[model samples]
Target: MRYEKGRKDASRSRIMEVATQRFRGDGIAASGLASIMSDAGLTNGAFYPHFPSKAALVRECVAAALEGQSGQIAQALASGGLATAVDAYLSAQHRDNPGTGCASAALLPEIAREQPETRQLYTERLMTLVRQVSAALPPHTSDPEAVAFGIFATLIGALQLARAVEGADLSDRILAAGADAARSMAQPRGGAGQEPAETGVTIAAKTERER
Candidate 1:
């Protein structure tokens, strides 16, 4: 018997949602299709109707995740500028909740090893994210796109490190350090021979050095 289109679509959405969390919480390779299907309340056979293969599901999920993150970052930037966005990304809640946190922090290594098509999709989505940040930067900032990339990389790397290590104190420090690094990168991208503006972290460091 043929299922209704709406039902099929709903089933596909459920599968993607469950798989996205599973893949992020557990590494992609570790999250088996059987487990994902089961978690989605579907039998193994129900999988093929929505997606031809596991890789296809992964590609779609990653793309969706990046799109969601871009929207969130845009909102944060709008409300409190890049600083708020950076803090939200590197917060302890984000670090502890890999299942619901940044896809890059959860799966960058796997992403690097994905097939060419998956990488291409990720690259395009990444550029969209970069553009979102670039648009938020100051008009006087030099190479805003490049600065956005630096800021994103800093946030992603710091979040991953924070999640990997043991201990609450160390993890919190990692988040703080990551926020500082990301903010430092977000500082004014000065023109030639001009000083970049000082961030809070930099000002504190300079004061410590003077003392």
Candidate 2:
């Protein structure tokens, strides 16, 4: 019984993992259950036992994707501060890779059209991210929550715009510009005359292109 349960749990996890990649790479509407199941090395019939319906799977996948992104943001902020997190978020690598990138940027449009429950779940996850960003702001920032919201909005808009454009140079420029803007916003208001913070994210992004 223990082995069977363990095997079932593993299969369910694998299903969610593959579904996350597919839903992000191809829009949720474009990715069908049979294809997802086949990609997970399971037959179509195997999907029913794991997820009651396609929508159920989508809800689970959406939650998992957002949780994963939040975890990355928290780690980035912990290791390198807000500047590092912002820089990495608005970097070219993240822009080019939607499958493993921010869920909001990759699926906001489709999410808007989802059922109310799905939207509610997304909203909860989004607020979690906002709170994380808010807490990571500099100590002197007057209104951390509002500032965090603004920063988060900027990041999402910049990524969406960058991906919408056709040229590689233009995309890189957008990401760089966004990163600079985010870093500047993170600065304390009274420190306008102080030296800029040291953030190697932009430099790293440029180097990635050169390599």
Candidate 3:
């Protein structure tokens, strides 16, 4: 019984691993169970025993993706501080690779239109990310949560815009602009040689208004 259970668990994990990549690489709505199962090297029949419904599978995939992203952010914070996290997140490499990048940037817009349960799960994970970034913020900040929120919003919006824009030059500009803004946020007020903070530009917002 134990061995059977272990194997079942392994199969379920493998399915999730494949599903995460597919869902991120392809939009969640476009990634079907049959495709995911085949990608996992399992029969379609194997899916139901692990996940009762497509929504269930989606929820799990979202959870797994967010957890993975959270770990990456946490590691960045621990190893190189907020500036490093900002540099890593707002780079061309991250912008060009949605599947291996941040889940919020890859899925938040679509997830916002999903069922309440899906949104709730996303909200929880987003807050977890907020807290992780918040803790790394300078101790004297007036409100760490708000600062974290602003930075989080900036990171996701920048990455999305970078990927959405038509020209490589514009996209790279968007990312570089975001990295500069984030670096400003991480610096202390009145710190030596630090220039005054400027209002950040968000190409996503401007592009949406134009559309």
Candidate 4:
């Protein structure tokens, strides 16, 4: 029954990796540990050593996905700016592959129904994400955090709606509309966050502490 530290760590990681995709592809309530363990190539008994319960696993998986997403958003914004990030997020590929895409888009409803601890973790992580986007907003922007929140809501809602509806045409239209709406949400009142549409929304200066 004894496993080395490294082996236990690897097994734990594998479990989370498989569970993340499973939870996103099939709702959390629908994904069983038996199946998740099977997918992770571990026996049912191995799971208990890594996590006390399915709720614990769910918390870990949610945190992992969001942490990865933070890097993705940073990369997208750095390479091409906000529009590119929005396009990538609202793309057909992302919509079709919920198993490996945004956690919020795939699991928002389930997260809302999770225990208070999990919900609190989500809120804290979400604020970090919002801040990342907010820091990139143009100078003199009015309430950039609120703007980022709106943009994230538009993107997450649009993706969820797109995946729910039947037909490529409607889904594509939804995605397109979502992108436009997210960009518009970023544009603050009184021309504070204004940027040339074609030029893309570049990052504003961040202080050394922020960096």
**Cα lDDT for residue 31, candidate 4:** 100
For model 4, name the residue pairs that clash: none
Clashes of each: 0, 0, 0, 0
Scored by TM-score, the top model is 1
Runs in model 2 with CA error above 4 Å?
1-3, 191-211
Q: Which residue pairs in model 3 clash with each other?
A: none
By summed lDDT, which 10 consecutive residues of candidate 1 come out lowest? Answer: 183-192
Per-residue error (Å), model 4, residue 22: 0.4
Model 3: residues with Cα > 4 Å off, grouped in runs: 1-3, 190-211
For candidate 4, write residues 1-211 as lDDT tens digits.
Answer: 6988999999999999999999999989999999999999999999998899999999989999999999999999999888788999999999999999999999998999999999999998999999999998877677899889998999999999999999999999999989987886665455446544331223322343368
Model 3 Cα lDDT, one tens digit per residue, 1-211: 2349889999999999898888787888899999999989999989888998988888888988888889998899889999899989998888888877777788776788888898899889889999998899877776888889999888889888899999999998999988878776765665468654443454466677799
Rank all candidate structures by their TM-score, best first, as comma-separated numbers. Answer: 1, 4, 2, 3
lDDT of 4 at 122: 92
| lDDT of model 4, residue 115 | 96
lDDT of 2 by residue, 1-211 (tens): 2348889999999999998988888889999988998999988988888888888888998999989889999899889999889889998888888988888888999999999999999999999998999898888788898998889889999999999999999998888888887887787665667654544575677788999
By lDDT, the candidates rank as 1, 4, 2, 3
Q: Write the per-residue lDDT of candidate 1 for residues 1-211, one digit (tens) a residue.
A: 6999999999999999999999999989999999999999999999998999999999999999998998898899889998899999999889889998899889999999999999999999999999998888878777899888988888988898888899999999988988988887777755789777887777998999999
In model 1, where do residues sit more than 4 Å from their true spots? 189-195, 209-211
